[model samples]
Target: MPHFVLPVSEVLVVADGWQAEPDAEAVIHRAIATAAEIVEADLGEAELAIMLTDDAGMRTLNSNWRGIDKPTNVLSFPALPPTGPRGGDNAPRMLGDIAISYETTRNEADDEQKPFDHHLSHLAVHGFLHLIGYDHEKDDDAEAMEALEQEILAQLGIPDPYAERMD
Candidate 1:
């Protein structure tokens, strides 16, 4: 019941880069489905956006929003407030947005020797988890979140993303 809205932003794609690796719509849709199943998100009353961009755009967003000067692999901007009621039928919840750095993801996948699709799926899952209020700010939090991620990825035929380094 997951609904995905992948709006093409003013994002550039490097030739043969991560942006060119996977079919954009298919990748986003798969990620959305996985996330919705994991969180039991009310797809009828929920909306999420995913933006695929390059490192430069992501750096600007990260610096402006997070005060970080460098571009990271993925950034999640959850729309949920810190304190709010769980759910209601009155409105569709804005699950916020996810921006992924196509450049960084490609480079990381090359460096780590992981399939580009696998990496993309991992990041999408990571970003979607954030929308559902999952975080890795501490040991316990990281453990819980990572476990869920692993579970979801496994269900999708993706290998353990943290199996090698346990990070």
Candidate 2:
């Protein structure tokens, strides 16, 4: 069988709080790999970045980029498509960037009664989907996106994150 190549991800821990989760980077890498495989993204040479930050950093990003003054669990900034010709044959495609807030994610996991890693995986998958143009702007879009997320998470042995909401 042919080997499938997933995108190369660079994880940056920007906040000291993220140190509490030692396996955070590994969880993100696994989540992104699984998500890329499920989506069948042609990202063999593509690269993306994940930023693990705290609520304050996230608040600044949210406010500056989205004009929202609150901190969110995760945010994705999709890279704009390249307009000009390729610079080189080996130039890796720039996928985009994902930012996750440690405090927000932890709080959400505690409130939802889910494992920290499981919730982190969900957020990572969610952020990866956004990087690939999967959005939840509309009702149908949200349903589709959520279904995909559930599928990806299931493959990772995680329960349906939306199970509670559907009830």
Candidate 3:
């Protein structure tokens, strides 16, 4: 089997609400690492940022970037490809930024009766997929993305997040 490389991820906890999940950062890191390995793309040496924020912060970001006035559980901002020459041979490529809302995630997890960390891992994996140009705007795309997410999560001992809807 071939070895896969994981990206360099930076987790920023910007909201006090995120403190409720003390293992949130570790969960994100583990999700991203597993995702990078499972994904077909070679993300070695790539970089990305994960921002843990509250609903208010998410609302502001969503409004400013997507023109959505409400808060979302997770949002991904993919970085544009570099247009110029590389600064160095070892420079890491910028993948993108992922922002997650604490309150929204908590609510969704509670409502779905799923473990908080499991849901958190799902969102992180979903956001990371977006950074790598995987989108679910279409039915086919959604299926493919969700399948991949299930595979990655399964490797992490997480159950299918879409199992309820499938039934």
Candidate 4:
């Protein structure tokens, strides 16, 4: 059996100016699970944090870190080292962190007419993939990554998010 070792940091769910839904915690857990499967990594020892924030906080972060000055649905900072094999934490492999904008997620879900859980799940999985060094900057990369995400999400009983886009 697989094992997951996600120790969530408190800042991940600070929830300032955001009223978390009843199943928000479950959504985070499911995201962690989906990420573990997608990356083919043993999650039992994964140590990471997820931050859920409103648009203001996310916008500030985006501007400071990425210089985008906009609230993105999700922003990921991977902890893996560059120019070397993955795994070099020396201190439990922190796996960096993922910051998700609650405002963006909620608005996107409302616009898409999908469940909040579904949209949140997609972002969580998307962020997790980034932590493990997955990027969708190119067509080939996007297809491969989306396929992996679909497989992982399906394993978690989620519909294929890319199906409609492909059609």
Best by TM-score: 2
Model 3, runs deviating above 4 Å: none
lDDT of 2 at 36: 90
Q: Model 1, 1-167: lDDT tens per residue?
A: 32443322122343344536657547766866775676665445566777788888899999999999999999999885526666555655567888888889889989999988888889988988887788999999999999998988997899999999955
Candidate 2: give the clashing pairs. Answer: none
Worst 10 residues of 4 by lDDT: 2-11
Shift in Å, residue 154, candidate 1: 0.3
lDDT (10s digit) by residue, model 4, range 1-167: 44445544334566554476767767878777656855667544546788888888889889999899888888998775535666565455577788888889899989878888888888888888888778999999988889888887887788887776676
Ranking by lDDT: 3, 2, 1, 4
Q: Candidate 2 local accuracy as lDDT?
A: 0.94
Tell me the lDDT of candidate 4: 0.76
* TM-scores, all models, native as reference: 0.81, 0.97, 0.96, 0.84
Candidate 3 lDDT over residue span 1-167, tens digit each:
43766788999999999888999999999999888888858766799999999999999999999999999999999999989887778888999999999999999999999999999999999999999999999999999999999999999999999999876
For residue 22, model 1's alpha carbon misses the true position, in angstroms, by: 4.8
Query: Per-prediction count of colliding residue pairs?
Result: 0, 0, 0, 7
Candidate 3: clashing pairs of residues:
none
- For all candidates in order, the CA lDDT equals 0.76, 0.94, 0.95, 0.76
Candidate 2 per-residue C-alpha lDDT over 11-117 given as tens digits, one digit per residue, 9 for 90 to 100: 99999988999999999999999899888877668899999999999999999999999999999999999898877777788999999999999999999999999
